[model samples]
Target: MSWIYLDNNATSKIDPAVLESMLPYLQESYGNASSVQHRMGREANQAIEVARQQVANKLSCRTNEIFFVSGATEGINMVLRGVAEAYRRKGQHIITCRTEHKAVLSTCAILEKRGVEITYLPVDEHGQIDLQLLEDSIRADTILVSIMAANNESGVIHPVDEIAALCRRKDVLYFCDATQYVGKQDLNLETTPIDILTFSAHKFHGPKGVGILYIRRKSKPIQIPALISGGKQEQGLRGGTLQVANIVGCGKALDIAKQQPHIRNYRDLLEREVLARIPQTFVHGSKAKRLDNTSFIAFRHIKSAELMTSLPDVALSTGSACASGLLDPSHVLKAMQVSDEDAFSSVRFSLSKFTEQSEISSAIDELVHTVEQIRTLSPVWKLFKDGLID
Candidate 1:
C-alpha cells in the first residue's frame, strides 16, 4: 500500500532540485570550508558564502547576518545560552510563552537553575498570546523575549510584528523561532524589527542537519558568545566544519519553496471534509490565523495513537516530532486550556506545497473510516451515543 505523508511540519522530503544542487559538494567538492590556503577549499568557502546569500535573500537581510548551524535545536541553544552568559550583567530576566518548543522551554529551565528569572506567559483559548500581557511582562532587567513565529503543532501564528514592536519599545531583544513559518510565510527583516530569528532547512524541502540563524546588526550590535569553541567558523559564533552539501541543498530548497504555489486551499479542503464526515471532532486553534499547510484536529474520546495505528497508510503526528515519544499530552494543547482527554485525542496533519489533491482526498477517506472504527470501541463514545455524555 502506498503511504500518504502529511507530516511536513516534522520534516519535509528534500526536493529533487535541492538534492541535485547538493550532489557536487557531496561527491567531489569535499573541501573543508575552513581551509583557506588551497583552491578547492576556497571553492567550498565560496559555495558556503553563496548559500548564505541565498538564505539572506529569502529573509531580506545581509549575508553577514546569517549563521549556519546543525539545525534549529543548536541555533536555539546558541541564542538562549549564549545570550544568557553574554548579557547576564545586563539582565537576568527573560520572557516567553508557555507554548514554546522544547528547545526554548528546556533551555529556559536550565537558565532558571542558574538564577535567571523566566516568566512563561500564558496563551488564550485560541492558542494566541495576549499582546497586553506580553508588554506588561517586560521589566527593567528583562533581557530577551523568545517566541515561535508559528506553533509547530497547532500552526497558530503569533502576532510577531506586534511582539517585535513591543520588545523594541521596551528595549528588549526579540528572538523568534521561525522553524514552522520561515518557508511557508514571507518575512522581510527590512520591514520587521525582529532582533534574532531561526529556521531549520529540513522543515522546508532541504536536507536535514542544516539551519539558519539570522541576527540583525543594522539597528544595534547585538552580540552573543560562541556556544562551541574551535577554529574560526560562522564568524566565530559557531565553530565547526560547515556541512557544505546540506547548506547548498538548503539554499536550493528555500529558492524552490518561495516559488511554489500556496497549499492553503488544499489544506482547507481536507479540514472541511474531515469535520463534515466525522462526528465529535474539532479543529484546534481554529479561531486564530494559522499556517496554510497545517490542520490540527481532535477526536472526542479517541486517543491519537490508537487512531494513527488504525490508519497504517496515512502518515500523521500526535504533536511535535521531537516530543512525540513521550506519553504525556501535548504541552501546546494544554497551554490553550484543552482538557487532558481532548489533548490526547488530538492529531496534527501538516501539508507541503508538494501535497496533491488526490492525496488529501485519500487521507481524508481513510481517516474518517479509521476514526469511526475506533469510536465504536470507545466506552466514552458509546456513552455519548446513548445520550449519557454531553
Candidate 2:
C-alpha cells in the first residue's frame, strides 16, 4: 500500500535538491563554525553565511537580522525569555493566545512563574483574534505580544500586520510564530511590522534541528539569559556551535519553496473533491484566508483518532503534532468556540507542493470508506434512524 503523506504541517520531507546541497557540508566540511584557524571552519562559516543570506532574502530582511537556533520552539523561547529578562523593568505583562503552540504556552507559563502576567486573547469561531480585543488587551505593563501567523491545526491565518501595528503604536514588542506560514505564504519583513519572527526549517522541507529567528534591527533587543550558553554564537543571543549543514539545507529548501507552484488551486481541488464525496463531513476554520495547503475536516460522529488509525496508508493529524499525545479536544477549536462534537470528529490534512491530485483522490476514497464503516457501528447514527438522537 502506497502511503499518502498529508501531514506537511507536522513536518515536511526534505526535498532532494536541499539534500544534495547539504551532502558536502555533512561529509567534507564538518567543522566548528567558531574556529578561525582551519580551512574547514572557514568553509563551514561561509556556508552558514550563505544560508543566512538566503533566509534574509526570503523574508526581505538583512543578514544581520536573521539568527539561527535549534528550531521554532527554541526561537519562541528565546524571544519570550529575552524580552521578559531584558525588559522586566519596562513591564511585567505579556499578551498571547490560548491556541498557540505548546512552545509559546509553556514559555509563557515559565515567565508567569517568574512573576510575569500574561493575557491569553480569545479567538472567534473562525479562529481569528478580535483585533479590538487584542488592542484592548495591551496594558501599560505589557511588554510583548506573541501570536502565530497561521494556526497549525485549523490553517486559519491571523491579521498579523494589524496586530503588529497595534503593538508598534503601544510601544510593545510583537513576535510572530510563522513556522507554519513562512514557506506557504509571501512573507516580507518590510510590510509586516513584527518585531520578532520564528520559524522551523523542517516545516519547509529543510532538515530538523535548525530554525530561524528574525529580530528587527530598529527594535530594542532585550537581553535574555542564555538557555544554551557555551561559546559566543548567534551573536551571543544563543551560544553554541552552529549546525552548518542544516543551515545550508534550510537555504536550499527556502529557494525551493520560493519556486514551488502556488498552493491555492491544488488545495481547492482537494477540498472540493473530498467534500463532494463525503457530504456529511464539515470543514473546520475559516472559509476564506487560510493557508492554501491546509484543510481541516470533521466526519460526522467519527473520532479523529479512530478514522486516522483505520487509514494506514494516509499520513495525517488531529491537531498540532506536539499536542498529538493528548486525548482531550483541541484547544484551538475550543478557543474558536467549536462544539465538543465537532472537535472530536476533526482531522487535519495538510498538503505540500509535492502532493499530487491522485493522492487527494485516494485520500478521499479512503475517508469515505472509513466514515461509512464507522457510521454503521455508531450508536448515535442508529439512534438517529430511530428518531432518538434528537
Candidate 3:
C-alpha cells in the first residue's frame, strides 16, 4: 500500500521543485550570508535577499519586514518573550485565544510564571472567538494581543482582519501566527495593520528549519528585543548564521503553493462521505469558518489511537503532531469545550494542494471500516447501543 499522507497541517511533503531550487545552495554555494566580503558569500547573501523578496511578495509587505528564523516555534518565542520583556513597563497583560497553538500557549505559560497576566479568550462550541469578548478583554495594561490566523488542529479560521482592526482601534499591538494560513489564504500584511506575523516553511511544502517572522516597519512602531541575539543578523532582532539553502527552498515552496489549486473539494468529499457512512460521527468546528484542507472528525465511542494504528498505510493525526505522544485529548478540543469522551475519539485529517481526489476516497473507505471495526469491539459502544449510556 502506498502510504497516503493527510497530515499536512503537521508538515507537508517537501516539493520536488523546492528541493531542486535549493540544491545548488547546499552543494556548491556554501557561503556564509554574513561573510559578504567575498564573492561566494555575496552570492549567498544575494540568494537570501531574493528569498526575502519572494516571501515579502506573497505577504504584500516590505522586504525589510521579513526575517528568517529556525521555524515558527522560535519566531513565536522571540515575539512573545521579547515583547513581554521590552514592553513590560507599557503593560504586563497579553490577550490570546484559548485554542492557540501550543507554541503560543506554552510561551504564555512561561510568561505567567514571570508575572505576565494572560487572558485566554474562550471559544464557543464551533471554536470561534467572540470579537466583542476580545475587545472587552483589552485592558489599559494589555501590551499585546496574540492570535492564530488558522488553527493547526481543527482548521478553524479566526477573523484575523477584524482582530487586527480592533487592535489598531484600541491602540494595542497585534501578533498573528499565520503558520497554517500563509500558503492557503490571501494575507495582505500591508493593509492588515497587524504589528507582527510569523509562519513556518514546512507548512507550505518548504524545507523544515526555515521560517519567516514579519514585523511591520512604517506606521506601527513596536519593539521586540532578540531572544537569540549574538551577531548583527536579522537586523539584530535574531542572531544566527542563516540556513541559506532552506531559506531558498522556503521561498520556492511558497511561490509554488500560490500556484497550486486548493484541494477543498477533496477535503469536503472526505468529510461528507465519513458523515454519511458512519452512524455516530461528528466534525468538530464544522459550522465555524475553517480552512479548506482540514477536517477534525470524531467517531463516537472509538479511541483515535486504535483507529490510527489499524490503518498503518494512512497518515493522519489524533491532534497536533507537536503534541503527539501524550494520551491527552487535544488541548484545542478541550478549549473548544469538547467532552472528554468525544475528544478522545476525534482525529484530525489535514490535506494539501497535492492531495488527490482518489486518495480522499481511499481515506474515507479506510476510516469507515476502521471506525466500524473499532466500534464493534468497544464495550462502550455496546453499552451505548444497549441504551445503557447516552
- The best candidate in terms of lDDT: 3
lDDT of 3 by residue, 1-390 (tens): 578999999999998999999999998999999998999899999999999999998889899899999999998999999999999998999999889999999999999999999999999989999999999999999999999999999999999999999999998899999999999988888788888999999998999999999999855467889888799998998888999999999989887676345487788888889999998898999999899898999988888888899999999998788899987778899989999999988999999878988888888888888788888888999999999998
CA RMSD per model (angstroms) = 1.2, 1.5, 1.1
Q: In model 3, where is the ten-residue run with the lowest total lDDT?
A: 255-264
**Alpha-carbon deviation at 27 in model 3, angstroms:** 0.7
Give the winner by TM-score: 1 or 2: 1
Which runs of model 1 end up more than 4 angstroms from their true locations?
Answer: 218-220, 259-262
**Lowest summed lDDT over 10 consecutive residues: which window, candidate 2?**
219-228
Task: Please give the RMSD of candidate 3 to the true structure.
Answer: 1.1
Clash count for each candidate, listed in order shown = 0, 0, 0
The TM-score, computed over Cα atoms with residue i paired to residue i, of candidate 1 is 0.98
Which structure is stronger by lDDT: 1 or 2? 1
In model 2, the runs with Cα more than 4 Å from the true position are: 219-222, 259-262
Please, what is the TM-score per model? 0.98, 0.96, 0.98
